[model samples]
Target: MKNRTIDYILRATWQAVSRMYNEEAIKYDASMAIAFALLSIDREGISSTLLGPNMGMEATSLTRTLKKMETKGLILKEKNPNDGRGVIIKLTPLGLEKRELSKAKVKRFNEMIRANVSDEKIRHFIEVTDVINELINNKTIFEK
Candidate 1:
């Protein structure tokens, strides 16, 4: 247990995956986060407040990305009729196109992983990750 560190493994795996996505994103002049956000937004529309948490992004970062997407004409932010103070983000036709691209890239990545790894291993990995998240959420780590 001491020799095998979970955090180190998690970081290394995440970095490798990020690098792969970044390299692929370069062809589209986009970042993984932008692609992720594009896919995160719903077809109908999504609340501005929900976007950040859904993407695991901070408010400022989400705002900046949304602005950049808006500038690119990929998304349109309109008033949320139900929620006077909030905004709704919807994908433009261009955004929908880019979202499909992002989705394809993600699917390809996952397919490669599934081809290389066994389903049992993937299931176990997901279970481990869920348990880790649960532990973190409960603040159970390093507790007496």
Candidate 2:
């Protein structure tokens, strides 16, 4: 029963995230968009190889997404000065702007959800989410 409930919750969460992004703005591959959002917030540039594992993406998928982002002028890939073998990924100004817009939209969506949901339920949901995140992090359960 507990396992079933957890599985249902996980599926629901994924569906909600996918729907939220798909409905909001330009239609993009959700995973790639998520990667872009992470890069926008990452002060230090990230490596493509590191990103692929972190995002649970295959190397080829990451490469394709990076190429599209580069063509769109959303990101710049440069040789890492410290590690010549690595490529550093950084968001361009346009990418930063898009990220900001997406962040705002996400915030608004959250606000709407909060307004509709009871405070007690919202607090419980937050607590459950935090616990799940902690469990995944502590156990290193997520695919890399």
Best by lDDT: 1
Compose the digit string of candidate 2's lDDT tens values, residues 3-117.
4788687898788787666665555433435544444435566876678777777777677877777787778888988898998998788767666766777777789988999
Q: How far does residue 123 in candidate 1 sit from its true spot (Å)? A: 1.2
What's the lDDT for residue 129 in model 2?
84
Indicate which candidate wins on TM-score: 1
- Report the alpha-carbon TM-score of model 1 versus the true structure: 0.94
The global Cα lDDT (0 to 1) of model 1 is 0.92
**What tens-digit string does per-residue lDDT give for candidate 1 at 13-36?**
899999999999879878888899
lDDT of each: 0.92, 0.72
The backbone clash count of each candidate, in order, is: 0, 0
Model 1 weakest 10-residue run by lDDT: 1-10
Off by over 4 Å in 2: 1-4, 27-44, 53-56, 133-144
